[model samples]
Target: MKSTLYLLLQIFVLVIFRSDVFCQEAHKWGGQKDGTFSNPVLPADYSDLDAIRVGDDFYAISSTMQFSPGMVILHSKDLVNWEIAGHVVNDLTKVSPNLDWSSMNSYGRGIWAGSIRYYKNKFWVYFASPDDGFFMSSATDPKGPWEPLHKVWDVSGWDDCCSFCDDDGQLYFIATNFKLDPNNNKKYNIHLFKMSQDGKTLLPNTDSIIHQSPGSEANKLYKINGLYYHFFSEVKAEGRVMMMERSQNIHGPWEIRQLNHVNKTVDREPNQGGLIQLKDGKWWFFTHHGSGDWEGRAASLLPVTWIDGWPMIGEVGKDGIGNMVWSAKAPIAVNKALKIQTDDDFSAVTLRPQWEWNYQPRSDKWSLSARKGFLRLMAFRPLKPDDTVRILLRAGNTITQRSMRTKFNIATVKIDISGMYNGQFAGLTHFSTKSYCMIGIKQDGEDRKLVYSSDSQNLIGVTITGSNVWLRSSWDYQGLNRYFYSLNGKDFLPFGNSTQLTWGSYRGDRVGIFNFNRFATKGYIDLDYFDYQYSKQ
Candidate 1:
C-alpha cells in the first residue's frame, strides 16, 4: 500500500508539471515575461509608426518605402501582438510604376508619419510622401474600401502631416514645410491651417505660420483639458522629441515645456511617433529607433506620465536608471492574436498578403494555381542586379528571425530564356545595400547554369550548369554576412566571403527572392514552395 501511494504521488506531480509547461508556451506568444520587457516588440522593420488610441482599440501605420502595398495598417489591443489590418495604398502602379531605392529621388522617400484619428464616426488617415506630396484617405470602418487618396497640398518637401478635429467640429492640419530659405539656410519649418467645412480642401486665408523650429519635423497638435499641446521632433546631428503647451488662444504666446525631452536609442535619431492617453488615464508614447541603416529602423513603445501638467517620458528612479514597463496582457485583448500568416503553399492565384514587391510590382508578374501548388514566376530580360525595380520581396521585423526552406532540386527548377531582350535570370537574394547574396540560374545559349554571389565585395562565386541544388539564405544581427547552399537540403556548403555595401543615409537589409526580368516578356520559372518561420532570437 505504501509503495502504491508513493507511485501515485509521483504521477500527480508529473501531471501538474506538464500542465504548467503547456500553459507557459501558450502565453509565450502573448503576454510579457516576468520582470522582463520586450524591446522592439515588433521585430519587423516598421519605421515611423504613429499609434492612435480610440476607446480601447489601438491602431498604427508605418512607412512602406517603395513597396507596392504601401502604408501598412496595424491594430493592437495591449500595444502588442499586432495584426496587419490592411493596407492604405492598394496598388503602386497608380503612383510610381518604377521605384529606384538607390537614386536620390527614391532614397528616404515613401509614406512617413501616418496619422490615424476618429472624427464624427469616420476614420481619417493623413499620409505624406516627402518626394511627392501629402494625401488623405478615410473610411467608416477600420477594414474596408478606404476612399481614394485626396491631395491636400503640393508644397515642396512636405512630410509627416497630421490632423486634429476640435470639439467645436473645426478641422486643422499640422505639418512641416521643407522649402528652404536661401538666406537663412534652414530647411524644415512647422505650419498650420484650418480645413474647409467640407473637408475636401484647405480653407484659404486660414493658412498661417503657427510655429517654426529650425530642423524640426513631424509636428502634431492635441488638446487636453482646455490646453493646446504641440509635439515635434528636433533633428540636430542627434534627434530628440520636444513638446510645448499653451493655454491661451490658438494664435500666440505658447509656452515651451521645460521638462519635455525623450531619449533616443543609439540606432535611431528620434524620427517620429505619437502620444495617447489610455482609458485608465495612463499615458503612453510610441516611436521608432533607427538601426544605423535606413532599413534597420523599427518601432518601439515606452510609457509616459504627466508630472505637474508636463509629460515625463521614460522616467528614471533615484538610481538614475530608466525603467521600461512590461505587461503580460495586452491593453485590450482581442478575439485572436494579431498576426499575419507567413507560410506559403504557392497554390493561390495571388501572392500572400504577407508578401510585398520592392518599389512597384507588376500585377501579372507572378501567379499561383490550386491544382499544382507551385509558384510560377514569369521571366523577362534582366535589369541591373542591384536595382530596386527588379521584383523583390520585403523582410519585416528586426529581432524576429525568418528562415525559408525548400526541397526542389536545382535541375528541375528550369527557366525559359527564349525571349531575351537584354539579360535575365531568376534567383533568391538578400536585397540590401549594406549586404546581399544570390543563388540564381544564368542562361548560356540553350543551357542554364547556377551562379552564387555576395555583395560583401570580398569575393564572387558561381557554379555553371550545377545540378540537384537546394539553397538557403539568412541575415544575422550584425548585418547580412552569412550564406550557405545545399544539395540534399540537409547539409549546407559555405560560399565565398564578401564585403558589405552601403547606401547613403540608410540602414538594415531585406531578404527575399528576385527575378531580374525587366523586359516585360512572358517567360517563367517554377518554384516548389517557400516556407518562412519567425522566432525571437
Candidate 2:
C-alpha cells in the first residue's frame, strides 16, 4: 500500500507539471543557450525597417505593402528576439476605397516605408502609400490600440518618410519625392518639409531640397551632439549603398559621404535602415541587405562606431566604409529565444497576433467564433464583373504570415470541405505579388478534386472523397518548393514539380491560407490548424 501511494503521488506531480507547460508552436532562428546570438536575427522578411528604443524596450515597424493591419509593429528587448506587438493600420479600407476586396487592385501599393518614434508620451508611426498619400498613426503604447490613421498629406509621388520632433518643439518631415527631374531625368530627390505642431498637416511652401541623386531614397534624420545628420541610400554602380550628410544646422551647406564596402556580393550592399543607441552608450545600425531573393530582403544588425564625428557601419576599412560581419556578439544581454511570428491552431478567442489578411477582411466572409476551434473562411466572388477568372491572389480574407529562412521548412494546413460549394476553391499557397502557387481542393458541382496551380499552370489531380484533407508546401533555403496532399493526415504524397519562389514588388514571398469562389460567392472552408516545422540544414 505504501509503495502504491508513492507511485500515485509521482504520477500526480508529473501530470501537474505537464499541464503548466506552454505548448504552442514556436521557432527561434539564431537561438543560443549561452547569452549569445547570430545574424538574420529575424529569419523572416522584415524589410524597410525603422526601429526606435524607448527606455528598456525597442519598437520597430516594417513595410507590409497591401497587407491589412498594415505596417507590422514589432517589439524587442535585446534587439535579437522579437514579437508582433500590433499593427499601425487596422482597416486598410480607411486608406483607400480601391483597397477594398471589391476592387482588389492595391496589390503592390498600399503602405510603404514608415518611421516609428516616441515623443511627448505617445508612440508615432508615419508612412506613405504610393497610390493614396502620406498617413500617420499614434498610440500611447507601442503594443497599441492605435488611433485611426490620419491622412497628413493628400499628395502622391513621395515614398520613404520620417518624422522628427526637435528640441525646440519644431516639427519636421523628410521624404523622397518621385517627380521627374528634368536635369537628371529621374525622381530620387530628398526633400524636407515643416509639419504642424498637431502633427496633422504639412506646412505649405515649407518644402526644401536636401539631397538629389539617382535612386536616392530611404531617408532617416538624427540630431546628435549639436550636429544634424541625414542618412539616405543612393544607387551605386554595384548596388544600393548607404549615404550620409551632416551640417551643424538643419538647413545649410551639408557635407556628404558615400558609406560602402568592397565586399559587394557578400553583404548584398548594405543600404536602407536606421540607427539606435543603447543605454550603455553604444550604437548599432539596423540594415536590410538589398540583394533580394524569393524569400525577400533580410534584416541584419551591425555594430556602429563613430570616428571623427561620422558614424561608420560594419568594420571601418582603409576606405572608411564598414565591412559586413557575418557573426558578432549580441549587443545587449537579454538571451531569451523568441520569433516575430509562428503557426496557429485557431484555438483562441481572437486571431493570433502573427496572422493578417491580404486586405481589410470583409467581416461577413470569415469567422473564428463560428467554429469553436477552427478558422472558417467563406468564399467570395471577384471584385469586378468582367473578371471571368477568379484569381486566387486577389481573393479577400486570405490569411498570411512571413515565411522564415531555414535550410528546410514545411507548412501544412488541414482544411475541411464539408461546407464547400460548387466553384469554390480553398488551399494553402506560397504567395508573392508576381507569382503564387496553390495546393488545394476545388469543388465542381458534386465532385471534389485535388488541384495544384502555379503562375504558369493549373493541374487537377484525382478526386478526393473526404470531408477533411491536409495540404502542404515544403521548400529549402534555395526557395524551391513542392506541393503535397495527405488524405489520412499522416500519409502524404508529392503532387507537382518544384516551384522557385520569387520576390515581387517591395515584399517577399508569404505562405497563405485562402478560400475563394471561382464562379460565385457560395461556399466556405474550415481550416483546422496550420503547422510550420523548419530547421537549418
Candidate 3:
C-alpha cells in the first residue's frame, strides 16, 4: 500500500520534475565532484559495517578482525565523502590475551558484527564475538576516547548484536546466537535480552527467542512511528538477503518482510549495514556487499523510500521490493569529493590512522624516533616458527592497510636493508592469511638477493647490490599483480611473474610492511617512505 505522500511524490516527479523517478541506475565515482554519486562509495574493504547519523554528523564503525586498534570508526558529513574518525579499542588484548602480540591466534574470529547508536546523551557501541563473548563501550563523542572495551557477556555464540534504548529509558539487547546440536549442526536463533540502563550488562532472565531461521544475523533494532522494527539478514533461496520484522510489541506476533532488491550492480547482495532517516525526512541505507572477493565488502549507499510505514531501500519496483541503484543523488550535495589519507611517510610521532598492525603490536618491536623520519622495524621471530608456507602470515608486527579496489593500484616502498640479518625476511607484502605474495630483498649471509615470492615460495631470486632499493607492486582492476624492483628509484625492472592477490580470512588483500626472522630476533630495517597511488578508472 502506497502512502498518500508517496503517491504525491511520484506524481510530483512525473509532473513537475518530469523524470521517471524509478529509472534508477547509473555508474561513476561515488562522489563525482558533481551533484551525482555512484555505488560503492568506496572501493576498499569496509565490511560488516554499521552507520548512524547524529544531528548532521554521520559516523560509521566497521569490523576489523584481528587488526590492532580494534574497530575502525569513520566519519562523514554528506554520506559520500568519508574519513577516519578514530578506533574503538587500542589494545585488542582487552578482548583476549590471545589477541596480544605473544599469542596472535585470533584470525577471522576476533570482532564480529556490532551496533552503534546515540542514546542518553552518549555514543554507544555494542558488538559480539562468536568465540569470546559480547562487549560494549560509550563515549561523549564519536571521534573518541571511548570507554575501555567492556565485556558485557563472557558467553560465546552470540554474534551480531545491537542496543536499543526505548522511550521509557529501558535498554534492549538484540542478537543472534549459534547453538550447536548433538549432530554438530548449528541452530540459528535471534534472541532479545533486556539490558541494564547503563549498557553494561544484560539483565538475567530476560532472554527471549524472538525470531529463528537459517543464517539469521546482522541484527539492528529501531523504533519508528510507534512500532518496533527489527532488521537482520538471512540466507534465502535468492541469496543472503536483508530481512525485517515489525510489531507493536517487542515480543510477539511479528510480521516478517524482505529487504533485498534484485541487485543490478556487480554486487551479489549488500546484506549488512544501517539505515537512517535524514533530518529533511529523506532516508538512506549505508551497506556493504556481503560477498568477499579481491575487493572485500565494498560499501554502497542507497536511497530509502517509505511505503505504508515500511522502508524500501534502493530502487522500488512494482512488486514493492527494491532493486540496486547503481547511482544516485548525493545524500548531502557537495561539489568536491572528500577522501582519507593513502600515502604515508612515517614522519609522524605515531602511525597514520589508516594503518593497523596484524594484531596488538609490541611497543619494543617498532619505532618512529629510532630513524628520524623512517619507520624502524626490528625483525622478530615468528610466534609459530613452524608455518613455513606463507611465513609472513605467521609473523607478528606487520603493519598494513587496505588494498583498495581500483582500475589500477601501485604501492611502492623505499627500504634501507643495510641492517638486515641473513635469516630475516623483510620487505613489502600483500598479505592474506590464506595466501600471500612478497617482493623484497632477502639477506643470504652478507649478500642481498632480490626476490619475488608467492605463498612463501621464492618464485624468483637474483643477486642485487643496493643498500637502498625501491620495490613496487602493481595490480590492474582484475588481473594478477606484477612486481618490480629499482636499484635507483627511477628505473623499475620487472622482478617476477605476476601473482594473484588472494582474498581470504574474510578480508581483502592488505598492503603490508613485514619483517620476521626464521632463526632468531636479531635484525632490523628502516623504511624511508611508502607511496601508494591508485586510479579508479
Model 2 Cα lDDT, one tens digit per residue, 1-537: 999999999988765653311110123345456665556676667888899899998888988887887898888888877889888888888888777776777777988898988887889889988877899988998767898889998888889999998889888999988877568576777889999997889999999998989888889988999889999988877678788899988885899987666334445666778889999999988777666656677777878889888888887889787777655678887546556557789999878788878877888988889889999999877554344233766677789988876768899999988999998888988888778888888899999999888878879898989899999889876678999999999999999778988778767889888888868879999989999987731
lDDT of 3 by residue, 1-537 (tens): 569889988877665432211132322346765577877787778988899999988889999888888888988888987888888888888888888778877788888779999989999999877789999999999878899889999988879999999999999999998898798988899999998888898999999999999899999999998999999998877778888899999986899888765431345588889998888989899998887767567788988888888888788888988778778778787524457567889899988888989989988999999989999999888977777775676688799988876767899999998889978878888877778888887777887788777763576477767689899989876536888889889999997778877678898888888888888888998999999997742
The 10-residue segment of model 2 with minimum total lDDT is 19-28
Instruction: Please list the C-alpha lDDT of all candidates, in the order they appear.
Output: 0.57, 0.81, 0.83
* Prediction 1 global C-alpha lDDT: 0.57
Candidate 1: residue 286 lDDT (0-100): 70
Best by lDDT: 3
The C-alpha stretches of model 1 lying farther than 4 A from their native spots are 1-31, 96-105, 236-238, 258-267, 316-336, 339-341, 369-372, 382-423, 433-435, 456-469, 487-491, 498-507, 518-522
Sequence-dependent TM-score of model 2: 0.90
User: RMSD of each candidate?
Assistant: 10.1, 11.4, 7.3
Better of 1 and 3 by TM-score: 3
The clash count of every prediction, one per candidate, is 24, 0, 1
Deviation in Å, model 1, residue 448 alpha carbon: 2.9
